[model samples]
Structures are given as C-alpha cells and as structure tokens.
Target: MDKRDYYEVLGVSKTATVDEIKRAYRKLARQNHPDVNKNDPNAAEKFKELTEAYQVLSDPDKRARYDQFGHQATSGNGGMGGFSGAENPFGDFSGFGDIFDMFFGGRTARGPQRGEDLEYELVIDFEDAAFGVEEEIQVPRTETCDNCGGTGAKPGTETRRCTACNGSGEQQNVVNTPFGRMVNRRPCPVCHGRGVIIEQLCRECAGQGRKRVRRAIHIKVPPGVDNGTRLRMPGAGETSPSGGQPGDLHIVIRVRPHEVFERDGTNVYVDVPLTFVQAALGDEIEVPTLDGKVKLRIPEGTQNGTSFRLRGKGIPKLGSQTQRGDEHVRVHVITPTGLSERGKELLRELGRELGESPSEQTRTFVDRMKSFLGNS
Candidate 1:
C-alpha cells in the first residue's frame, strides 16, 4: 500500500508552524497511543505513523528535502542526517521522556534543567576533511556563577517564595468563555518560573546565576566528513540554567574548495588535460592523487572526456576505516592553437598522408548538422 502524505497523516497543513504540528501530533498521539487505546488492535500502527510523520516534518532540513523529493529522499536512512528520532524533532526525546511528562504531569519537578545546545560552523581544508585532524577551538558559553554557587541570591541572602504564585512557579489566569471560565497556567512574572524571588542579586552574575565565559575546546574531526556535517560533542554546551545536565555542542563541517579536485560523497573527481597527440597515441601519464602522484595508463584511441577510476585513492568511508572510495580522472583532449606557418604546413601534410576525409569527431558533428537541416 502507498504511504499516506505526512501532512495528511498528522492532519496538519503543509504551512503549519512547528508549534502547531507538535500540538497536533501530541493530541492525536494521546488518542491513538497503544497504552491509551489497548482495545484497538491498530493503535500501535497509528501511533507509529504519527511519530514518523512528526519526526520528518519537525526537522527543517528533512522537511525541505521531503517537500522537494518526497518520501523517496528521507527514507532508508535510519533517520535524517544519520541521527535517531530521539535526538531531533524533539530534543532529548529518548524513552518518550516528553510524552511521559505530558501524560503524568507537566514540569512538576523543576530542578536543574539541562542547558541549551549550541552550534558552530568550523571551516577546514579539503584534505583535512578527507583525512582527519585534531584542532583546538574557542567557544563562548554561559556557565554557573562561582560567587553564589549557582544561586541568584547574594552571599548570606536567601531566596523567598514568590508572592505572586505562592511558590507554585506558575500563575493561573481565569478567562470567562461562552461555556464556562477557562483557566490558563503561566510562569510567575516575579519568579520567572523559579518559584522563588532573590532578595539581592549576585555580585558576579547580576542575579542571572550564570556568566559568559570563553572556553577552549579540543575537537578531533573524523575522516570523510563532508560540508554541512554536524558532529555532536556531549557536555560541551552551555551550563544548565537551573543546574541540570549540560547540552551537547554541535560543530558543522565546512570544507574549502580544492583547485583540482571536487568531492561528491565518498568519490573524488579531477580533470586531466591531455594533448591531441597524447590522446590519439596512448601514453603513460602521471596523475595527481591526494597522497602523491601515480602513473595512469592512457589507452590508444582514447576519446576526449574519457574517465578512468583509480580504486582506493579517494577518501575513507565515514565510519569504516578499511573501506575507501575511488578517484575519478576525466581526460580532456586539448586542441593545439596559435600554430606557426611551418607547423600548419606540417599538419596539412600529415592530414593528407593519413586521410583526406574528416575525423570521427568532425564526421559525427557534420552528420548531425545535416540531419538537423534536412540535408541528410
């Protein structure tokens, strides 16, 4: 059976906002969830479909690719961009953590929450990306204050329960609807969701409980990393706002342009310009490889734009150290120009000695032209 459209699966429009999609998925998931609907045999399948649709539509890159290429582009990759569903769409959604939070209670225990994730684009040489390199980088992140030990209150001062929310960390607003009064719960303005008010601000962090610091981090880039590739480093992001786990740091790879080589996935491509005589009469040629120069055999009567592959001369596979890609060399025949009088005469004599007829290239073009003009 053909798969249903992702938008249709989630009952959302294609132009729906991220928040809208999330809310729709959550509402439907609660209804069709296997645990919620044990009597319905197909509830598990429906929940899976909802999760898959939410995962794809929630990611910006995957959604763009799906919009252009449809499901054919995003399937069979385990997940988009080599990641599992637990990491994206819903950050740190492993073990259905967020869903469980909603099913049980929302944000009831407000201990140290995890820090925010950070992204940095690191540009490197093409060779470095092809191989591997270790480099040191400086990243600016917010860390817990040392003066007050992560507490916003000043030394010897204590935090008191918020007067507005009465230590609930949230404020309730009652609105009168047509049916009845609707109550909306929001974070307390005085406590800012902390449920407590600091009498005096910390001297160092100004009551923020965190300070901006530039930290030096060392990163080891693996081989065969391509542009836009994101590497995750755990515990390297900003410190938790309330004292929880630190978020992961993501570094995006950007490879510099090479003068002779262009990379496509695991393959490397290079153009080799050969003289007409060399192409017509086979010769052993020296070709440039990433490591060093190697001899390449040019077959006799080799045509222009003939490509040859050198195995195991390209980049290593991303996760496999033993497997490597091939290097492709495209040989282009260069026609000699700026001929002297003697050189032209010699060429004319050689043409007559060989044959007065047109070469294969010229004959093929002439035949096409004649056919196009209806003179064939």
Candidate 2:
C-alpha cells in the first residue's frame, strides 16, 4: 500500500508547531492503540502509521529534509531512516513510556520498589489553624520486619537466586507482527520480579518482609493553613516490601468553623454588635482576635455596617513568623426595643434639638446618595 503523507497521517498542518504536532499525535495514538481498541483489527497498523509520521515530523533535521524532498528524503531499506521494518519501531520515539504506560501498566524490573503512600484527614480548631499547633496522630501501616531484618528469609538462612529467570527477574516472549519480530518483556512469575527466592520464611512476617503496626507521628501544623490544605510527611508511609525507600504520608487539613470569626486566606472578619448610643458616640470596645481581645476605638457618628481595620491582628502568613494579615471588624448598630416612657421622651427631646424632620431627613439622604454617586 502507498504511504500517506506524514502531515495527513497526524491530521496536522505542515506549518503546525512542534507542540501542536505532538498533541495531535498523542490524541490519535491513544484513540487507535491496539490495546484500547481490541475489536478494531487495523488499530495496530494505524498506530504504527501515526508513530512513523510523528517520528519524522518531530525531528527538525528529518522534517526539514522531508519538507524539501517529500517521503524519498526519509526512505531507506524499506524504512524511514532505519527506524521501521526489523528495527525497533520505538527506538527513536521520545516520551514513549509516558504514553504507553497507560495501556501496558509500567515496565517491571528487578529492584526494590517504594512503599505505597497514605492519606489522612485531620480536623483542627480554627484557632489552631490560625496559630500553628503541633499534633500527634496515630497511623496504622506496614513496617519493616524485625525478625529477618527486612530480608524475608529466616535469621540464619539467606535468599537464593530465582531459578525461573536466573536472577534476571524478567521473562521475554517473541511476538511476530506486520512490522517484524518484537520482544515483550515481563516480570518473572515465580520470583514476582524480586530476582531472589526466600527459602525459610520469617515467622513474624510470613516472608512478606513487613509487619502491620500502629505508630504515633508528630506533625507541625503551619499557620495560615486553611481547610483542604495538604501537608506531606516523607518516609512516614508503609514500609517497602523489597526493603526500598518508604513512601510519604499526605495530611489533609479540615478547619472547624469559629463561632464569632470567619477567615479568608490570611485575613479574619468579624461582626460586632453595637448599641445605638455607642454608634452615635465614641467608645473604646474590646474585640476578639487570633491572639486575644484588643481594644478598638469606635469614632463618633459611626454608621451601621462601618468597617474598621486592626493591623497585624489576623492569621499569620504561612512560613512567616512576623508578617500577618489585618482583621476587619464590621459594626451592626442595634435599635433599642421596649423603651420606657421616660426614655422615649428623652429621645424625642434629643431629636427635636437635632432638628429632626421628615423633609430634612429625605433631603439629607438624597444629598448623601448624590455625593456617593459623584465620587463613584
């Protein structure tokens, strides 16, 4: 069959950038991969064609030559520059493992593997999140066996080389394909890719080389860590079965909501209720903060919903000991209820002295609105 144009095979323009070409190739390759489309008899051939196209277009020198001379520039020995036919089709393909691993799992080799990572959700008080706290947590995980010193073999005996693969830990099978012969390598079934066999198993771990136990771990909760924040502790996860480096423990934080304060990022917000007299006249009132109660000055003629800022009174920035956010306090003026006759008369007299009238109040409100609109 005559070969299709490289650009047409990848469904990209001749002027497409390298990134665009790569994206196009990856999309089509994943869709037509033989393992993904098992029912499609021609999926493998299509994938090979896509790979061949990407192999040429992705290389600057090959692409420049092909642009000038077409397919003849890359043709040699019934292949594209010794990359097809009997040669390994993936020999020059960069990042092949990144795409192929999704379909074929991953490469199996003889070595110690890292342990599995674990995740834990920790619920903490809002104040604890604002000001850093040290917490001790109990985690149940697998630890290296003490009996055999993580070797899986009994104290006196040692592990022997795998008889099935002769310590290589890999088994190869020859596959005949349209391109040519392909060798598929997989882990040895008998040794499970360990390359060694334990003759006398450890009595405590039963040859697993690990035992399950609960351990107490201390974690430092940094300040300004809001809900859903994640903290990673390395080497605090399950022990490696093959005695390799351990994995990590991931902690997800959940901050309990405060009754009086709300947090946004490092900033803190709170609503303080003030009596009508306090809002009309100046007063010094105590306000709650992350540290403790602090006195804030309320200016005379303070209106409802007026916000005041207290500097350096909010949550500390993560990793910063001195830098902190400001706390915003919004005042809500409360109207008095069930007033006494004497109180009502005194209020009326005060209103008269202030020249309170319906028309005057409307005009004043209108003027304030106009001033606000003009400024805006």
Candidate 3:
C-alpha cells in the first residue's frame, strides 16, 4: 500500500509545533497500540505505520528535509529506530530533548526542570473541618542540599564533557541494508544523555544532589474541606535529581470522625436524642456546633424521626457557594425505660382518664382486617 502523508497519519498540519506533534503521536499510539487491542491483527501494523511517520515528523532536521524535497530527501536516510547497535538517532537532531522530556516526564535540554511532587496524608479534628484552622505538619521529603548548592559536585569543581558521546550525549550510527542505509540514535551509557558527568561525587549529598530532611510547614485548611481533599503547597516537594528546581507538596486531608457529628461534603449531619416530655411539651435544648453550643427549639407534638435544620451552622463553603450549608439534626424520642412507683400510678390514672387502649389507639392493617371481618 502507498504510504499516507505523515501529517495525515499523525492528524496534524505540517506547521504543527513540536508539542502538538507529540500529542498527536501519543494519541494515535494509544488508539492503535497492539497491546491495548490484542484481538485485532491490524493494530500492530497500524502502530508501525504511525511510528514510522512520527519518526520523520518528530525530527526537526528530517522534517525540514522531508518538507523541502518530500520522501526523496530522506529516502536513503534511516528512520528513528533503524540502528542494530547502540547509536544516537538524534545525534544531529536539535530540539529533540525538549520533545522527549515533555512526553516521557524527564529532564531534557530544557532548563530548570521542576522536581517530583510529594503527597502527605493529614488528619484533622471534626471542629477543624467546620471552622478553618492552621496547623503545622512535619513532612519528611527530599529537599535541595544547602552544602553543594543542589549540584552533585565536590567543592571547587564542576561537571566535565562526556568522553563517550563527545559532549553530544547521544551516539549515532548508520546501518547498511539491501533497501537503503538507515541511521539511528541512542543515549550514551557513560553520559546518560546529560552531555556532562560529575567526576567526583558531592560529599554532602553523596552525588545524588539532594538530602532527605523533615520540614515544618504550616497549612491553612479551609472550612468545608472534606476527607480526601488535597491542598497543594508549591516548592515544598523533593528537590530535582538534576538540581533543576523544587517540586510541590500535596496535603491529602483526612478528617477525623466526630463523636456527635458526621459531615457529607459541605453539609453537617447530627442525631439529637430528645425525651418524650420534651418532644410533647416543646422545649429548647442545647445543640453542638463548630463554634460552640447553640439553642434549638422543638415544637410541641414533634414526632420521633423529625429533622430540624439550623441554617449556617454546618460546614463552610468550598469555592463556589457564598452561603454556608445548613446543619440537620434528626430527632429521636426516647421512652423512659425505668419508672418509679408514683410515676406508674400516675400513668395508669392518666391512661384510664384518657381512655387510651390498644383497640382505640391501634390502626394497623390488623385493625382494618377486623373491620373487613365485621367484628368491629
């Protein structure tokens, strides 16, 4: 089959930027990957086709040549992965490291690469979840070394050019084949693609360029932050292995269980038990809140399982809502288990005077069955 245009294969224009090209290639690779669709026999062929197209388009020099002279310019030249042995396909390829680093999550020729981010789990009290509070947390992480100034080098010395790659950081070779000569590029083992190497390791950081230490960081957790919420602290993560830049620290919120209250998102839920007399006579009772105790009134004849809402007493707003959530207190009327002799006599007299009986008070399906049977 005739080869498709490189731009069409990658779903991009010829003028697409390097980042755009990489994004397009990654998307295609994922869609047509053989491993992802093992049942499909054509997936591997499609992947190989796309890979070949990307090899030329991803390279600035090869892309430029292909753009000017079409396939004839790169006919005899090898594609990206044509080497039989260790060779840098990108030996003459400029702007290659930046593209590689962006896709593969590593430091390339790009300067000042940020460090790896760290995550720390934090547990807070129930009251703290309602009302925002500040607390200091001790986080053990890899931080930039102060002794060698984040460089993994001994004092009064610096990195030298790698002899293996001759400062190119990549080894390149051309392979002779029956069809044509193919060129390939691979990272130099000695230099590890850095183009430079430290002759003497740093004494303080042990040539790793970082030191592990504990830091006291104060975090202001906003109200309404529920369990599993994450707060990001910039420049608080581990130091970059290449001494490029500091990473960020992620604080994972773990709200401790409250004795009386349970939170669901920004809303607060609590179960309040009330006496039979209090529910019937209507009385004010003390309700616990994040700030302090507050008074709540129960209306007369308030049945069990009744819920009363206290507006603005629940958890605070996250980022969108301006008003706070309301607190819901579910009421459960408790009957007295133990009664004195005087209380029993008074209850007997009241029941007698009020004519309260099983037949008069009961209106269940059994009572309807009696009516249906004409026994009522």
Best by TM-score: 2
lDDT by residue for model 1 over 1-376, one digit each (tens)? 7789999999999999999998999899888866568899988788878888887888788899989988787667564633445444334345355664664455345566788999989999999999989989999999988898877789899888888898887887765522233344677888887788998999899987889988999999999899999999999998888668999999999999999999988899999999988998999999999989999999999999999999999988998879989999999999999999999888888778887535865888988998999963
What's the TM for model 3?
A: 0.68
TM-score of every candidate relative to the true structure: 0.67, 0.81, 0.68
* lDDT (tens digit, per residue) of candidate 2 on 67-146: 99998887886645556444455543335765665555555333678989999999999999988799999999999888
- lDDT assessment of candidate 3: 0.76
Q: Which pairs of residues collide in model 1?
A: none
Candidate numbers sorted by TM-score from highest down: 2, 3, 1
Stretch of 10 with least lDDT, candidate 2: 85-94
Write the number of the candidate with greater lDDT, choosing between 1 and 2: 2
Pairs with backbone N, CA or C atoms under 3 Å apart (clashes), candidate 2: none
For the record, the alpha-carbon RMSD of candidate 3 to the native fold, in angstroms, is: 8.0
lDDT comparison, 2 vs 3, better candidate: 2
Cα lDDT tens digits, model 3, 1-376, are 6667889999999789988988898777767755456798888678767766787887898788788877666554354435223333334323344433433344444455678899999899988866778999999988767787766678788899998999886776665532233345677888776677988878998875678899899999887788888999998887776657789999999888988988876778889999988988999999887767999999998999999998888887876457688889999999887899998887778777877855566666677888889963
